[model samples]
Target chain A: MKKERENWVDMAPDALLGYAVVVLALVCFMILLAIVVAGVRILTGMGAA
Target chain B: MWHRLTLEDVKVIGHYLGVLVLVSAIGLVPPLLVAVVFGEWHAASRYLLTSGIFLIAGSGLRFLRVQPGRLSRQQALAITGLAWLVLAFFAAIPLSMSGHYANYVDALFEAVSGLTTTGASVVQDLDHLSYADNMWRFMMHLMGGLGLIVVALSFGLFGKGSASLFTSEGRSEHVVPNVVQTTQFIGRITLAFIALSTTIVTTLCLVKGMEPARAFLQSLWVSISAFATAGFVPMSQNIMYYHSLAIECVLMVVMLLGSINFTLHAEILRGRIKTFFEDTEVRITAVWLIAIVMVFAASLAASRLMSDLPAMERRGLFMVVAAYSTTGFQNVTTSQITGSFASGMLIIAILMAVGGSAGSTAGGIKINRLAILGKSIVATLKETLAPDTARITISYQHIGRRPVTPDIVREATTVLILYGTTYIAGALVGIASGYDASQAIFESVAMASNGGITSGIVVPGMAWHLELFYLLEMWAGRLEFVTLLALMIQLVVSATPSSLAMRLHARRAQRRRS
Candidate 1:
C-alpha cells in the first residue's frame, strides 16, 4: 500500500497532483470534523445520563 | 539617522503612485459594465464619475516626472504604504455615492475593510446594494488580497525596485527567480483556483435552488472572497444565508487554500506532493488546526451554546475554520457569537491572532512566525541544558531544511511584538469608545489580524474616533507594521521645520567632531 501510494504520487501530473492534494485535504477535514462531532456527542450523552 | 524626503524622492513616488492609481481606475471598468448590463444607470454614472476623477488625478500626478530609475528603499516603502490608502480613497468615491452608506467615512471604512480583506462592513443596506457596488467591493478584495504592489508588479509596472516593493507589501517569498514572473505566477495560480472553486460553488448554488444568474454571480464573488481569504459575502446575512453544508465545506477548503503559502502551491503545481506535505507550515498548520478545532468544540459544548452534535459539527466547526483562516465568514449571527458563544470568542481571537501561513493572502502574525518562535523556545532549552563549551544549532523545514538563525528568530519576534502591541492599542481605543473588554479585544483582533469577525460593535453610526482607529488598525495590519512605520518616520521627518532639521544635522556633525 505504501509503495502504491508512492507510485501514485510519483506518476500523477501537475494538475492531477494539485487536485489530489485537495482531495487529501478534504478527507482529512472530514475525519477531523467527524471526530469533533463524535466527541461532542459522547460528552453530551454522558452529561445527560 | 533618518533622512528627509527630497524633491526627487517625492516626484518619483508620486509618478509611480499615479501609475498605480491608473491601474486602479481600470478596476472600475468591470463594475461599470456590471452596472450597465443591469441597467443601473445611476450606478453606472457614479462609476463613470469616479473613473473620470481617477484619470484626472492619476494623469496630473504623472506629470511630476523625475527621470525614471530604480526606486530607493525609502521610495519603495513610501509608495507601497501610500498605495493602499490612495486606492482605498479612490475606491470609496463610487461607494460613498452608492446611497447605501450613511456618510463618506462609512464608505471609506467599507473600502478599507474590503482592501485590507478584513471583511467588516458599515454599509447600511448590503442586501439592496447594486451589482456594480458589490463588484467594486469584491474587486477591492481581489486587489488587496493579491497585495496592491503585487498586482502592479505582476504587470511589470516597476523595473528595478520590484523586489523591495514586493517585500514592502509583506510578501517575502518568490516562487520564481524573477520578481515579475513570480507575481505573474501568483496571479495565474490565484485565477486558476478561483475558476475551479467558482465552478464547484456555482454548481452547489444551483443545487440549492438559486437562480442561474444570481448563483453564478454569488459563486464568482464568493470564490474570489474565499480564495483571497477576504470575508465579504454578497449577502448581508453572510454565509449563513445559504445554510448549505456542501457550500460551506467547499468554501472552507478554498479558504484554507487561500491561506496556504504560495510556494507550497507552486510545489503542488509542480507535482512535488511529497515536498508539499512535508512542508513545516503544512505540518504545523495541520496539528494546530486539529487541536484548536477540538478545543473550540469543547468550549462551545461546555457553554451549552448548541446542545446538538450536528449544530456543533456545523456551526462550531465552520466558525473555527473561518476564524483560523482569518476569513471572517460566520455561520453564527452576532447575537449568538457575543451572547451564547461569548467565551469561545477568545479562542477565535487567538486563532485570528495566530492566523495562517506567512506570504499568503491571510493576515495576522502567521504560522511561519509561530513555528519560528516555538523553535526558538526549544533552542533556548537545549542551550541551557548543554555543557558550558557546547554549541547548539537548531533547524526546521520550510521549503527546505534551514538553520534557525538569530535573524530569523528576531524577525519573527519583532512582528509578533508589533502585532501584539497593535492589538492591545486597538483594544484600548475600542474600550475608550465604551465597548466591553471582550468586545473590544475581539473587534481589535479582528481589525489588526484582518480577521473581520464582528461582535456587533462595528456599526454604521459607530463613533468617528473608533471608526478611524479601526481603519488605521486594518491599514497597519495589512502593511504588517514595518512598511507603515517607515512611512510614518518619513512623514514626520518631512514635516519637521527646516531650522529644526538643520539644527539636528549640526548637532550630529558636532558629536562626530567631538
Candidate 2:
C-alpha cells in the first residue's frame, strides 16, 4: 500500500463509516423504545398511570 | 445517459429500500393511534393510505430478488436518495388527500419538513387540522429526527445500505459494525428520553391545570419534537398557544438534548461523561449557544423592543436555541424582538446557518464544521509563526478525533458551498418575486437550515416558485448535501460520454426484464 493521501472525493469510505454509525444509532434507539414500551406495559398493568 | 444499474446493485438497493419502507409503514402508529383516540375518519383515511403505501412498498422490496452481500457504494447512495423521495411522496399523499394541501407536492413539502425534523410547514391551519393529521406530522418529525432509514435498518429489514442511509441522515460517526444494532441503540436512548421526558412534562402541564387529554397529547408531541430536534406544533400557534414557560423550558431542554448526538448520550450511559466536555463539537456548540444568547439579549434590551425585561431574557435564550439548534419551535415570532437588524435578525440568521450537532436531527453547516474551520484557522496562523520544518497535525474533536486534513476541509467547504449555492439560488428566485435580497437570503438560510424562523417570507399563497424553492431546500438540506450531489454526478457519469455504459447497463436491464 502506498503511503499517500487518497482522493478526498472518494465517498466510499465515508459513506460506509456513516452507515455503520447510523445502524448503531438506530439499534440503540429501538432498544430504548423497547424498554419504554415494556415499562409502559408494566405500568399500565399495575394501573400506575 | 447513466448506466442502468445491474441487478446486483438493484437487489442491494431494494434490500435497503425495503427497510426504509418498512420503517415508514410503522410510522403510522402515531397517526392511527390518534385516529382511534379522536375518531376522525378523514385523518384515519390519510394514515391508512400512507401506511398502506409504505407497507406495500416494503413488502414488494422484501419479495424482490436481493443480493446477499453488502451494497455497493453507488447502490447505497441510490437507495438512500430514493428512500427519502419514496417516503416523502407517500407521506404527503395522506395530507394531500385529507384536503390539508391542494396538491401532493405541498403536502410532501410539509411531510418532508416534519420527517426531516425541519419543522417548517406549508400547512396554515394546524390547530383545526384533524388529530390524525396532526399526529402524522409529529410522527414524521420523530422518524425524520432519528432518520427514516435508521428505523428501517434497526429492524434488520435493511443491512448494507445503512452506510449511505446514515450519511444522508447527517451523522458524522457511525461507530458500530452492525447497522441494525446501532439504530437500535439510538432508538433505545430516544425511547427512554421520550417516555421519561413526556411523562414528566405532561405531569407538569397537567398540574398547570391544562386539560388532561391536552396535557397527554401535548407532552407526547413536545417530547418527540424535542428529542428529534423538530419544533413543529400540532396547534396553529405552536408553543405560544400554551404561553407557559414551564412547557417551553421542558421543550427547550429536550430540544437541546435532541441537538446533541445520541452517541454522546451513549457515552454518558457508559459513564464516560467527560467525553462530552472533551468533544470539540459539544464544546463549540456550548460556546456558540452562550455567545448567541448574550448578543441577542443585549440587542433585545438595547433596542427597548422588550417591554418586559425577564420576558426578554427568557425568550432571547429560547429563541436562540430554537433557531440555532434548527429545532424551529417558536414561542416568539421574528417580529417580537426589537434590536438593530444587525444584532437580532442578522445574528439569528447566522445562528440558523450554524445548525445543530451532526447525527442529531438538526440541520445546517453543523458545529463540527465551525469547529474544524476554527481549528484550521488557528493551525494556519500557528504554522505561519513556526519554523519551516515544523510538522504538525490538528483535527476537530467532535465525537472523536476527525483529522482536519485538507480532505476534511474540502468536504466541509463543499458542504458550505452547496449550502450557500442553494441559499443564493433560492434567494435569487425570491428576489425575482420582488423581495429584497437580504430578506430572501435570511428566509433561504432559515429554511435550508430547518431553523424555521421566517421574517414573513414563508406564508400561505406565497409565490409558488419561492415556496417550491424553500421546499426543495428543506429536502436537500435534510439529506445533508451529499446524496443529491452524488445522485446527479452518478447519473451523469454512469450514463454519458460512452454509449457503452448504458448499452451494457441496458443488457443487464434486459436480462432482469426477461
Candidate 3:
C-alpha cells in the first residue's frame, strides 16, 4: 500500500499540474468563504445589538 | 519545398470574405429598423453609413474572378481568423460613432468582446446608451455565438470549402453531414430557443413591473444574451437590476441550454433522450456543475454573505452556473463580487476555465477535452498496474462508444496545455499591469475563456496595451488557438521572400496557361 501510494505521488509534474490547478482554486475559495461568512456574522450581530 | 500561397489564394480568400461581408451588411438592417422605431436618428445614420461601406467593400471583393476549389485547410483558417478581425473593425464603427465609448479602441474592445461572446464591455453608462446601439451589440452576440462563418454558410455562401470553414470556426462536430444543412439546423435550434426564452422572459419582466415595450425589448436582449451565453446586459446592474427570482431562473435555464453541445440538441430533437445522460461530456458537465454548486453553496452559507438559504441559492448557485457555462451574467455588482467573494473568485475563475461542452456557443477548454484527459489518466494508471503482456482499452460515449486512441489523447492534452499556457500568459500580463495575482488570474481566465465575468479590473481608460492584449486573447480564445496560430504561420510564410517570388512565378505560369 505504501509503495503504491509512493508511486502515485511520484507522478509527472505536468500531469500533477492540471489537478493542482483545480484543487488549489477550490481550496482557496472554500477557505475564503469561511472567513467572509464569519466576518459577516460578527458584523450583523454587532448591528443587531 | 513548402507550398506557398499564390495570387489565386489571395483572390479565393477575398471572394469568400466579400460574400461574408455582404451577408454581414444584412445584419445591420435590424438595428437600423430599431433606430428608426426608437427615433434615435444619430444611431440610425451611423448604421446606414457603416452598412453602406460594408456593402461596397463586399461587392468589390466579389468582383475578384477567382475560380473555386475547396479552400486548403490553411486558407480556411486564414479566412476565419481574418474575418473576425474585419468584422470587429466594422462592428466597432457604429459602436464608436454612438459617442458612448471613450475612443475607437474601447469600441473595438467591446466589439471583439461581443463577437467572441465574451460579454466584457468597456461601454460607460450602458443604461443611457441608445436602443439601436444596444441592439447592435447583442446582434453581434447572436451572429458571433452561431459563428460568423456558420452564419455566412447558412446563407448559401460556400461551395467545397464549407466543411473546412465550418470546422475552422472551432466547431468539432456537425449536426448533419452537409455543412449548410448543419448551419441551418443550428440556426433553427437557436431561433426556436430564442422565441421560447423571449416569451418566458418577457412575461417574467412584465410580472416584475417593467413597461410592456421595454419589457419585450429587455426580454429579447436578455434572452439572446443568455442563449448565446454572451452575458451582455442592457442595464448597468445586469440581471441584478430586475431582482426577480423568476427572471434569474429563466436566464439560468437559457444559459445551460445554450452551453450544451448542438449535436446533443439535434439528437434530443430526434427523440434520443438517452444520449443526454449517456454522453461523457454531458455527464461530466452535469457532475462538474453540481460539485461546483455544492462548494459554492457551502461557501456562501459559511460566509453568511446572503443570510439565508434562498439568498444563497439565488446568488451563489447562479454565479457558479454563470461561470461554469462561461456566461458572464451576474446578479451582483462587480465590487460586491470582487470584495465579498474575494476568496471564491478562484473558484469562479476555475469554472470559467473549464467552460461548457464542445460544439456549443460557450467557450473554454471545453468539458469534452477535460473528460478525455480524465479518461487518459485512468488508462495510464490501468496500463501501469496491469501485467506487461496485457493490453488495456478505454472508451467513452460521444456520438457512440469508441475506443480512445493515442491520437485522441495527444490532441486533448495539446489543447489543454494551450489553454493553460494562454491562461497563465494572460494572467501574467494582468499582474505586470499592476493587478493583484488573484484578480489578475480571475480577469485573465474570464477574458481568455470568453467568460466575460470581471473582477473589476477591466475599464474603459485603464491602459491601452492591456486592452490590446485582452482583445487578442478574446480573438484567440474564440478560435480555440489552432486557427489563429495557423493564420499567423500562413501570413509569416507567405510574406517570406522565397514565397513571394514563388507566388510571382505562379502568377506568370497561370497567365501563360491561360
Candidate 4:
C-alpha cells in the first residue's frame, strides 16, 4: 500500500504541472482583462464628461 | 545556381487562374438572382458588370492556348496567392459599384476580409444595405472559406497541380485519394450542414417573432456565415439583433461544426466515430475550448461584470466559443464589448490566435501545430532529463500515432514564429498609427487569425496604410506563410535578369581596380 502511494506521488508532478500551467494562464488572462476594462472605462468616462 | 523562371511558368499559372476566375464569376450568379428577385435592378447591373469582367478576362486568358501541364511548386504557390488577390479585386468592383463604400480600398478590404473569412467590415449602415449586396458579402465568405482553388478544382479544372494547389491553400488532408473528390466531399458536407442549419435557425427566428422574409434571409446568411465560421451578419447589431438564446445555441453548434476538420466529418460519415475523439488536433481543440470558457467565465464572474451567473455563463461562453471557433458573431455592441468584456478581451484574442482545427475553414496558429509543438516540448524535456543512452520517442495520434520528428518540430516552430512576428508587427504598425496598444494587438490578432471580432480599430476611414497592412495580414494568414514565401521568391527570381550575376561580377572587378 505504501509503495503504491509512493508511485502515485511520483506521478503527481506531471498532473500538477498541467494544472499549474492552466492556473497561470487563467491568472494572466484575468489580470489583462482587469487592466483593459479599467482603461476603457477611464477613457470613455473622460470622453463622456 | 537558382534556375530562372521560364515563360511557361507564367502561362501555366495564368491558365489555372483564368479557370478559377471563371469559377468565381459563377459565384456572382446567386447574388444576381437575389437582386432580380428583390427588384434591385441597380445591384443586378453591378453584378452583371463584374461577372462580365471576370468572363472576359477568363476567356481571354483561356484563348492564349497555353497547354495544360503540371504546375511546378513555385507556380502553384504563386497561383494560390495571386488568385485570392485577383478575386478580391474583382469582388471589390461590385461592392464599390454599389456606392456603399466611400472608396475602392474599403471595398477591397471588405472583399479581403470576406474571402479570408475574417468577418471585419467597414461598410456603414449595414441595416440599410440591399439584400443582393448583403448576399454577395456572405457568398464571399462561403467561397473563401471553402477555398476558391478547391471550388475550381471541384469543377475538374486542374489534374496534376490540384494536390499542390490544395495544400498551398492550407488544407493538408484529403477525404478521398483524389483531390477533386475531396473538394467535392467538402462542398457537399458544407451544403448539407448549411441546409439543415438554415432550416433550424429560420424556424427559431420565426418562433422568436421575426418576420418570415427577414427570418429566411437572415437565416440563410447566418447559416453560411456559421458554416464558414465567417461571422458575418446581415444586420449591423449582429447576433444581438435577434435577442434569442435558441438562435445563439444553434449558431454555436454550427460554428463548432465549421471549425472541425472536414476530413473528420468525412470519417464520421464513413462510420469511423472513434476518429473524432481520437484525433490529436480535435482533442487539443476540445480541451483548449473548455479552458478558455472556464477562464472567460471566471473572469466575468470575478469582475462582477454580468448581472447574474446565468448571464455571465451565456455571454461568456458564447464569446469564448466564438473566439475559439474564430467566428466573430457578437451578441454585444462594440462599446459594450470593449467596456464590459474588456477584462476578458485579451483572453478572447488569445483564443482567436490559437484558432480552430487545421484543415478547416478557421485560421490562426492552428490546433495541430500547437499540439505538435506541445509534444515536441515534452520530447525535448524527456531527452534532457533522461540518461544519455536513453532513446526518447514521442508520438501523438493524428490519423495515427505518428512519431515526433525534428522536421515536424522545426516546421511547427517556424510557422508559429512567423505568425507571432507578423502579429506583433501588425500591432506595432497599428500603434504607430496612434491606436492604443491593447486594441491594436487585439485587432491585429483578429485580422491575422481571420477572426472577425473587432475592437473598433478597423473602420470606414482608417489610415490607408493600416488598411493595406490588414489586407495583407488577412491574405498571408489565410494562406499560412509558405505559399506567400514561395510567391515572393518566385517574383524575385522572375524579375531578376540572368545576366545580373555577370554585371555584378564586372562591377566588383571595376571597384577593385579603382
Best by lDDT: 1
Ranking by TM-score: 1, 3, 4, 2
DockQ of 3: 0.02
Candidates' TM-scores? 0.94, 0.84, 0.89, 0.88
How would you encode candidate 3's per-residue C-alpha lDDT over B373-439 as one tens digit per residue? 8998998999999999999999989878988888988878887888899899999999999999998
What candidate 2 gets wrong by more than 4 Å, as runs, is A1-49, B1-4, B7-15, B61-63, B175-177, B334-343, B396-403, B493-514
Best by TM-score: 1
The better-scoring model by TM-score among 2 and 4 is 4
Q: Predicted candidate 4: interface RMSD? A: 12.3
lDDT (10s digit) by residue, model 4, range B1-514: 5544567878777877888888899899989999999899999999999999999998877665666577777778889999999999989999987877979999999999999999999997889999899999999999999999999899888888898898889888898898998898899779988998999999998988889988899999999999899888999888888888888877877787798888877655544556666888866765676566655655665454563444664676678778888889888678766787788889989999989988898889999898999998888899999999999999988666788889988988998998999899999999999998989999999999999799999989788999999999999999998788778877877677755676678889999999
Error of 1 at A23 (Å): 3.4
Query: Judged by DockQ, which candidate is best?
Result: 1
Q: Which digits, one per residue and each the tens of the lDDT, describe model 2 over residues B383-494?
A: 9999999977887665567778998888888888898888788778888889867777778888888887777777656667777788788878888778877766765665
Q: Which lDDT value does model 3 have at B160?
A: 88
lDDT of each: 0.88, 0.72, 0.84, 0.83
What local lDDT score does residue B480 receive in model 2, on the 0 to 100 scale? 74
Q: Is 2 or 3 the stronger prediction by lDDT?
A: 3
lDDT of 3: 0.84
Worst 10 contiguous positions by lDDT, candidate 2 chain B: B334-343
